[model samples]
Target: MSITRSQIADIAHLARLALSEQEIPVYAESLSRVLGLVEQLQRADTAGVTPIAHPLPGQRQRLRPDEVTETDQHELYQRNAPQVQAGLYLVPRVIE
Candidate 1:
């Protein structure tokens, strides 16, 4: 998990970052500590653990009935439009 200065320089180049000579060693040390933490987490045991969609158990999401509750009001909405023809809104052409 020890990141070198050259590795930091390469990472900076790949990420399109401008890192000075002084900043390379600082980034290398920081990245090395992050990699060490990831390495420690990889050693943890996660066997026999069931993956859960929700954090709280026995909590089901309530859903409303899928049915039309309102009547058609197309003509009512079209009355507010400035220009509407053949049940479609008409707009001024912009592109040639």
Candidate 2:
């Protein structure tokens, strides 16, 4: 999992990044450490583990009651429009 200077250069080229000679070694070391961590995690045993949406199994999300709170104002709003048909506003076609 150890990243080399040439690998860092290739990665920088693909990512369209401009890395100085000093920065390349620093990035290579950082990326190597990250890959080492990934390799360590790959050795973990997750055979009996099940994927979960929430961390807490018994927790329930609180939601507001499904109810209409606003009165219908479409007719009032359409009164100011230049042209409307079948409850829809009509606009002039600008493109062929």
Candidate 3:
């Protein structure tokens, strides 16, 4: 699974990257080395492995009770807005 200089050049062209003549060889060598590493990984033994979300099983996110702790100043929050209307921050229209 060896990558060629031409393959790297083609990839760079497709990605709209302007690689220099010297940089092309560097990129080709770099990509080849990376792919070689992946090939080695593919040869390794991973027979029975279950993909888990948090790496640790049965671990839930620590969360406190969703209760109102303190009241916030509505006027202070609105003071920073460029435009505030009817106690709400007014956003610019996106539609033409």
Candidate 4:
């Protein structure tokens, strides 16, 4: 697939990008190459490939256990607040 100067200009305008006249030609060539690569990839045959959730097929995702590691220290922090109720800091209502 080939990208033209007019298409590049339109794309730049739609994206609100300030592309100089010199940069437009460079972008057109780069975008054309990217589209060409995508077209090439689309032609590849993947007849029997199984879709996977994770990139590594057989490995279990290493994750930290669902457990509390930090102690509740809100009360200590709330001592300096002007107002606190039910472990929530009371802020002045600005939007009426």
Give me the candidate number with maximum TM-score: 1
Candidate 4 wrong stretches, greater than 4 Å: 44-96
* Every model's TM-score: 0.46, 0.45, 0.44, 0.45
Candidate 2: clashing pairs of residues: none
Q: Which residues of candidate 1, in runs, are more than 4 Å off?
A: 45-96
lDDT, candidate 4, 35-81, per-residue tens: 99889777778889777887876898689999999998999999999
lDDT of 1 by residue, 1-96 (tens): 999999998999999999999999999999999999899867778798787988999999999899999998889999999999998899998687
- CA shift of 74, model 3, Å: 26
Worst 10 residues of 3 by lDDT: 49-58
TM-score of 4: 0.45
lDDT of 3: 0.85
CA shift of 95, model 2, Å: 32
- Extract clashing residue pairs from model 3: none
**lDDT (Cα, 0-100) at 6 in candidate 1:** 97
RMSD to truth, every model: 11.4, 11.5, 8.0, 9.3
